[model samples]
Target: MGVIQLPSPPRILCFSFHILLILLQQTTAERELKFVVVVFRHGDRTPIVNFPTDLHKETEWPQGFGQLTKIGMQQLFELGQYTKERYSNFLNRTYSRQEFYLQSTDYDRTIMSALSYLSGLFPPSSSQIWNPGLLWQPIPVHILQKSSKQKLHFPLRDCPRFDELQNETQTSPEFQNRIQPYMDFLQTMAVNTGLELNHLKMLDNFQLWNTYDTLHCEDIHNYTLPVWATKDVINKMEKLAELSLLSLFGLYRREEKSRLQGGVLLNTILNSIKQAANSSKQGKMEVYSAHDTTIGALQIALNIFNGKLPPYAACQFFELYQESSGRYSIEMHYRNDSSKDPYVLTLPGCTSSCPLEKFAELVSPVITENWSKECGKQDKMKDIFLGFDVAVGLLCIFNLVLLYLLYHYGRCRRRNNYQDI
Candidate 1:
């Protein structure tokens, strides 16, 4: 005590400085996120198509089929506000032209939804240099077109492997088990409607697609659907559509296609992260505006199927930050509504702040073709065989029906001759 009492000013000064340095470092770390990636579903709209019995048809929608509605615009605007608040610390006080980028699948509704969302996210601030009368300034929104066969937007590309995956899904034991309940429900619907289960128009995938498209068109035109298709039916149909996307992406087989698509998207994300890890420039955020199908497909790929369609404005966000140890970690958040907080996701064996390299490795199997090679050519051939079997079965049934009719006619002719004799 006596030794310490000899006025240790140097020691006191050093200790105070050290404490201040620690506080400064903590503050910097808290505010030092460098990059963000967000993928989102497009906002609401009239049904893309209608059913056979729809009362209000495609012509009723002012913009024609598949256009966003006024309410959709409002929903996206609110979503933009939520995004702004959630990332306020990482984002600039006001959006900077240089700090953000956007991309959308090439479709009117998707592109327009992105535009609408940005309008609310970065509304004009005092520092904005727009012409006095302008409501907003232009931001660059990129689009990817001709990347695949189907032009219907994200989750609609015609991949042969994806088709094979869908076939595998139907035959998979797990899928049959999961869908047995729904099949029972469909049978109940058929009984109530006095429709034969086989004759039920909604049984086939294309028929379901047509029904949805027709409903979409009708909703746009302000036409009404049949009593049988109450709001609940429409909602259920939407869920089925979302499940179809998962089927295509192999979500049902977590060890297979989910790994591939998830790996592909994950690889793209990791590459973006590594590119940003060393950069000292103001960090950037990339937003992808797309459809529910796209969100569903990606979710299946990631083993995150939640058993419902992602709402029109649902979003998945990825943030990258650096730790004091000089390693980078990633955090993922999902926002499905304007009023709710985002939910966090941590990879297996990783904390909420996961190392970038580890994250890449965890999902590497998804993007590489090595796993597909293991499935072998037989899986592909099985798909072809199953398709032909269904086609030939239908032809045989048709021929049988035709022959039965002819036999009945000949029997009636012979009966009439005997009566004349």
Candidate 2:
């Protein structure tokens, strides 16, 4: 044993140092939530449309189809109250226009939902009251017309590339694989439900969902259920309907579709966060009152969709935080159920308190600077422009050649006439 000196304790020392580094990261000081962004679906409402077999007609509902009911108002009010309580410390006791911005789709249901939510969020105190009879104060809720509602809503059907993506998703192996198992069931349901089997195959779950939701709502309100509308049957329909929705926004090239639709909203949200983070002023919240598609699109973009129709008044929260060390982070939570706490969500590759820069980096792929350009529409337009320029150039050259030929013939005719004279 020639001088076999005991190995130095470097390896053990290195292990101890590595463990301490992890411990330090784990025990970093807590961060405070600085700003909040809430995107929620409008509360429960009558079905948007009724099936032929549906006993529950749109006329039965007080406000007709798709309008927010009293129950819907209550749901949003409760959500607002809950929000008020949760951010009591963060928000000013009275509403400030500067501190909050509320926006909704142009639809009546969405606009009313925002108003309902505001009622619970900031009930006017004595001095703030414009009218003593009403506890509410008017808060501006912005909207974009149906023709221009792309940024706030989901499944923006205007983009041809998105339509192409949906077609591709339908034919994709994953979509085919997932739906194959349910084809027989869907066919049977279509027959009973009076929906065309082919149409069922090309499922628009959101549309199908209206039928089931109407029947379910009727049953809940003590209306007699149809013979085929048992609880189990409704549950099955609801599941399949959800699958249809999933298929629409999920599977092959989901990211690309998201970039066109949901990612637009995400880009807006991130831009808002960046603006808030960079600016010295701060706000308590921003609420985007929209539809179930809005929630689904956002959840899909965030990769945290629960794979079901988000219930009425479902709220998705994006909370911004400032750490003790002056670093900012983002946290997300989803409140689909009133009885339970909002589900805490972490970004795919980040911790609960994800740093703002890291959050942006993680979501960069989904966001787009130019929606039309990224959707391939702008490129198509560019190609059309080039083709149009070439066509115009050829037309101009042909006109010049025709003019030269005419001029030459006239000159020869005039020269012959002059020689004869």
Candidate topping TM-score: 2
Tens-place lDDT per residue, model 1, 393-413, is: 999999999999999999999
lDDT of 2 by residue, 187-275 (tens): 77787778877767776535466667777667656767778776788887788778776777766676777788788899889888988
**C-alpha lDDT values of all predictions:** 0.69, 0.83
Alpha-carbon lDDT of model 2: 0.83
Kindly report which residue stretches of model 1 are placed more than 4 angstroms away from their true locations once superposed.
1-31, 94-97, 148-158, 187-223, 231-242, 259-262, 281-283, 369-421
Which residue pairs show collisions in model 2?
none
RMSD of 1: 13.9
